[model samples]
Target chain A: MLKIEEYRQIIDEQIQMLGGMKRPEGLYDPVRYILSLGGKRLRPVLCLASASLFGEYSAALMPALGIEVFHNFTLLHDDIMDQSDVRRNHPTVHKKWDNNTAILSGDAMLIKAYELISKSPVGVLPQVLEVFNKTAIEVCEGQQFDMEFEKTSDVTEEGYLDMIRLKTAVLIGGSMKIGGILGGGSLRDCALLYKFGLDIGMAFQLQDDWLDVFGDQETFGKKIGSDILNNKKTFLLISALNRLEKASKKELLHWINRKEYEAHEKINAVTRLFQEAGVSEVLIQKRDDYFTRSLENLGKINGDHEMKQEIENFVHKLMARSR
Target chain B: MLKIEEYRQIIDEQIQMLGGMKRPEGLYDPVRYILSLGGKRLRPVLCLASASLFGEYSAALMPALGIEVFHNFTLLHDDIMDQSDVRRNHPTVHKKWDNNTAILSGDAMLIKAYELISKSPVGVLPQVLEVFNKTAIEVCEGQQFDMEFEKTSDVTEEGYLDMIRLKTAVLIGGSMKIGGILGGGSLRDCALLYKFGLDIGMAFQLQDDWLDVFGDQETFGKKIGSDILNNKKTFLLISALNRLEKASKKELLHWINRKEYEAHEKINAVTRLFQEAGVSEVLIQKRDDYFTRSLENLGKINGDHEMKQEIENFVHKLMARSR
Candidate 1:
């Protein structure tokens, strides 16, 4: 079985090829640009890793590229919707070009992704497409719910969790499941692998929320408490809201509603409230529980034991990421 | 064979089912809203008609819905990009809700379209998807070209024709080709059907350009010279620029470069230039040649004689629409 780095390298190479389409510069340039602004290539790597667990990882390469392209497509549009100026320390597509280019290029990238995924072996193409289409719809729904939550104050922890599951976790899970399908895993094993990926994704996202306020600034690669400054409805925020007493809850709400406070003041104040309410401990416990569950799910997969252990090691390394 | 109205009704009923997914009201509502504000349902109806010409029309139903949803998906995003205020005389999705909703909803609709198309019979699924994906990419490229032309002054007649072919004609051709594939038509016949649709689509768009200047406003159901008012580079405009004398070309360029002018005066002047250059007659002749070519391609199809004749009659009825 390939190491995680090997899988990532494969994904990176394929993404570079995707960027090489030169025609219709107005449409493809942004696609090339956004693909060049590299992320960890986590989803596709997981797909490759999962595929290698059961059978030939090579067969999963096209579908893996598909997932990467689809992920980037979402980021391209989401950056526009979020009005973000920078991604990966560079100007976003919408910022570099314009919204129309971003919208059209993103749409084209989606079709490109489908084109790539359609290369899945014919026997499994239908199943691969079904999972992908369902995941795609859920991701959009999740984004809608996330936007809706921005204006909504009474968001429940369950609602937040569900939102993240739909927005982030399902794609991860779907990626692994697709890899499993393409790699010739039995349906039963694929289902188990999917659960494993979903658990890891949940933990990964919760860790992200945790790191936003609590991690080392140098390591996190983003300003700590940026989510707090934006009054984002993360798991920590919802838990803090639900667990806090009257005064603390009112104070949190005040900071959330304030339009003129200094950024650090708001961030510090919200961080204090979260700490005082012990939300950090609650969040860590919840994240750890998911991590454990993911390992348990992985334990049930009927794959080569050594490869399974490698995946377990990989999961630990991923969850151990500080940012 | 189902009448065009029956085919339209089938598409309408399926689109209704699509909107029935009531969860994520923010995402689904705009989808429902836009789909409800009806247009010709042209692509899906064409798919049904073409499918019935070869085999069981019902076999094409899901894919037909797919094409309709996809067509609407493009419109939803195009309206956002174009900043169109109204569609079918109702507020566009972006105008009614917001840009974010439109982007997200349009995305969900694209996914929904894929899900529907994935229902194509397993035997032909890959071929159907290949055609759909290629067509989808071309449509995006076409929209990109159209937008680019807004800033580009050197756009040639060939470029404009190619843009419309990508933007409009391919979808029409793709719809018919997909229909033929699903209905068990010979691959050769499907290819012929695709060309037939493409030729008709080219003629249809040219007709639309002609009518923008010449049709009665009441009959056109839009401002008679809206394209002229917008400085859109239609076939007539391009033809006039190419066919005119040096003096006349200078005059046309002057009008095109003018920053401010009365809409009717500009439209009238441009219309006069087109008339003097005999561009209108050229355009009509070109459109007719395409119509003739479309009939010739249809004649080459080895489908049932009566079915072919029905399609020929339908083509005549469609082209005869003055507005």
Candidate 2:
């Protein structure tokens, strides 16, 4: 079993190599800056780990790095679209620079990702590129779905699930699947690993929804119930809207309708209503269900027992974390 | 060399194939709408011609289609960034749909370009991907430079040339080069073809600039002097600024500095001064220089005399056209 630290080092090194090129004066700097402001490297790590399940992880590092580049490229553009002020506790690329720079730099990042993937040895390049292309298209599909959700009403739970699956889960699933393919895993094993990642990603996102309202403020690394303040349509809120009695519905609408209510007070009232309506318990149950399904899928993959245990332990650690 | 109509048919067919996939609901329809509002398909034609100079023109159609997709992808996002209302006499994608949709759809177009390139046989995929990637990054870099120009007042003629080279010329050059490479041209021949396309692209853009200000109202196919009205820094305008005496400089500044003015009066006055100062003649000379240089490079390429003549005739026709 490979050490987590070893995987982390490979990702960082590959990132450095990918970025080390003759970029235009102002263009490449922003790309380097965004890559430098690193996150968990979760996607690439999954790629490496999945690859390691069948073959040398080192062989997968470049392709895994490609996934990382693609992920960051999406983030750079997403920040501009979302008008986000900060990312990873730093000013977003668009915030610090201008939107045009952000847009162009993000464009370069996508190109760079393809460049990295194209550098993979000839044998695996075609398969790696195919998976990469599909995942890339799916990510864009997810983004479009997300944008549509903003102007829409009556979004079904199924629709929301599909949206998140396309937007978030599929990339994670694809990353693992790419690793499996690159590592010479059987097609069935690759498919199973992909499913495992998808389920885990779904569970992870639901947990994120849970944390928005119910998480410990200190440990969660953000204020609790912030979603209610912003009128975000989380699973709990959507379920509560659907299931609440007439009186509770009216009360919930009042809080949502008010444009200038106190954030904390509105959140508190919304949390209370959500709890009373059993939305919180329902979301928790759904999260647990997906998490269990993810574990089941993971259990079915035929890999070294020791490697499997290591991956399971890592995933457990991820699930147990508060933030 | 192939007949122009033959090249056009191949390009049209390839474009149809590239755009054949069903766009997920609410996502990419507007992008498809904008792309379907066709233009002259000149870039792809050049690509096919350049390739046909060495081998079968049909071999270059998919690669040429890749360039077209990449070009449209840039247009989709650039429309959003520039807040453009119309493109090709139709509503820009962002205007027709929304900014987010345009952004995502443009992204999908970019990914689709990769998908198309990856479809090339394994023997050529790596080189095709490499050139494609480099060209893509350069396009973004050029766009970034253009954006930077908007905020800065000290843009030089050299700087403007460099920006347009990235933004416009490299893609055209790369399209031809990719075609040449895929058509089994030697590396040296591919390099010469790229130079030829690049020089021709520069001349093409210079002509575009000239037409923006001085083109006949009916023949130009767009609003005359629109660049002046929007204060765009074109080669003639920049040269006028550089060469103007004190009085002319002040007059030019007045027109540029004014927040609002009669469109006709301002355009007429600016065009008059541009001509009086010989900026137009200088620009025309520069444009011709590029055209001559492009032909010179084309002459250096080792190919059949008849094939070379066919391509030369096509270039002449392109240069001679009004719109």
Candidate 3:
């Protein structure tokens, strides 16, 4: 059975092999630029890995590329919407070029994604497109909810979970399902895979919230407590808001409402309040619960035993990352 | 035997029937808002007409909606890029909602277009997607070139024509081709339909340039000579720049280079130069040539006689429109 690293390597190679987007330097250059900025390639890797579990993984390559391209297209436009200047330690497309370039290039990348995904075998093309289109629209809705939550002071944990489910988890789930379908997995097996992926995605996002506060900055690849600094509604913040006592809640709200404050001081204050509210422990428990549920789904899938073990090992490694 | 007006009415009915995009009002509302701001429905009407020429027009309805939705998607984003406030006598999406709303909603609209197009029967789905994807990418390239041309001088007529073909004509051509494919037209017939649509598209855009200067304000539905005021590069402007005498060329150049000039004076001066160089006659002749070529392609189609005549009459009605 192929390991997770092997799948990721395949994805990287396939992504690099993408070419023939030559003309209109103004349009294609940003696409190439964004794709070149390396990330974990989690979605495509999961797709290829899931495909390998049932049959040949190679058929999943084009669809996997489609998922990754769609992901990056969202990022390019999101950066402009968020007014974010830096991404992966480099200037964003909008900042490096201009807003119009980002918008137009992002649009082209989206069309490119559709073209790639349409390469799926004709027999399963309709089903593949169905999953992709639903995921795509959900991703946009997730973004809308995320933006709305920024202004709405009374965001619920349920609402946050639903938002992340739409924004982040559905695409992850859909990617695995698409791979499974292309891999000749049975409908029952595909459904199991989708559930597995959804649970894992939820855990993955919860872990992201955890890492923003508890993990080391070098390991997290982002500044600790940056979410708090932005007053970004995360799992931890929502949980904290629910669990905090009146006095502590007042203090937390004061910090959140503050227009200006020293960075370290605010981070320190929020971190302390979160611990006092005991939401850190609650978040850890919830993340582990989701991880366990994901394993349950994965274990139930009637695929090759070695392949199942490989997937299990991969998720264990993902969950075990600490720092 | 259905006339163009009947095709248009069918398009209007189908467009009105679009529903089930309920949640995330922040996102879907703008989509509904923009679609409500109607236009000629020319693309969809053309698709339906071409489909009727070969076989069942009903089979083409979904794909026709796909074309129109895709067209509107481009317009939504274009309004943002152009910073235009008004469209179809109402505030544009960006102006009415916001840029982020327009951007995200426009993205969803693009996905909706794909979903609608994907409803094409399994036999023709792949071909339909092929045409749509190629056209979508070309449209973006066209927009990029259009933006580039704004900052560029000495843009040749040939280059300008290529840009418009990408930006405008290909979608028109693709729409017809998709309709033909869905309508069970032969490959040769579909190819001819594409050519017909392409030629008509070119003529339609050139007529737009003509009407901007020569069109009556009330009848044209836009300010006369607004393109001149904006220093837009049209066939007349480019032709006059090429054909004018030395003294007249300098005068034209003076107006073109001037950062500040009376709008009416500039419009009058440029209008005079265009007439003097006889480029108005040249443009009219070129537009007529395209119309003639379009008729040649339509005449070659081995489809229903009345359908062909209907298409011919439709283009005639289009070309004959003047202020």
DockQ of each: 0.89, 0.66, 0.87
Question: Considering every candidate listed, which one attains the maximal DockQ?
Answer: 1
For candidate 3, write residues A1-323 as lDDT tens digits. 35788888877887887755878899999999999998989899888888888999888889999999999999999898888999999999999999899999999999999999999999999999999999999999999999898888788888999999999999889999999998889999899999999889999999989999999887677888889998889998988888888999999999999998999999999999999988888988888898899899888888878888988888888876773
Worst 10 residues of 1 chain B by lDDT: B314-323
Tens digit of per-residue lDDT, candidate 3, span B1-323: 35788888888888877855789999998888888788889999989888888788989999899899999999999999989899999999999989988999999999999999999999899999999999999999999999998888778888888998999999999999998998899999999999999999999999999999998787777899988888888888887887899999999989989998888999999999899999889988988899899999899999989988888888888877773
Question: Each prediction's TM-score against the native?
Answer: 0.98, 0.94, 0.98
Per-residue error for A115 in candidate 2, Å, reads: 1.6
Interface Cα RMSD for candidate 3? Answer: 0.5
The deviation in Å at residue B48 for candidate 2 is 2.6
What would you estimate as the lDDT of candidate 2? 0.83
**lDDT at residue B179 of model 1 (Cα atoms):** 94
The digit string of per-residue lDDT tens for model 1 on A186-230 reads 999999988988889999999999999999988788989889987
Model 1 Cα displacement at A32 (Å)? 0.9
- Comparing candidate 1 with candidate 3, which one achieves the higher DockQ? 1
Residue A75 in candidate 2 has what lDDT? 93
The sequence of per-residue lDDT tens digits that candidate 1 reaches over residues B228-260 is 888788998888888899999899989999999
**What tens-digit string does per-residue lDDT give for candidate 2 at A75-99?**
9988877778888889999888887
Clash pairs for candidate 2: none
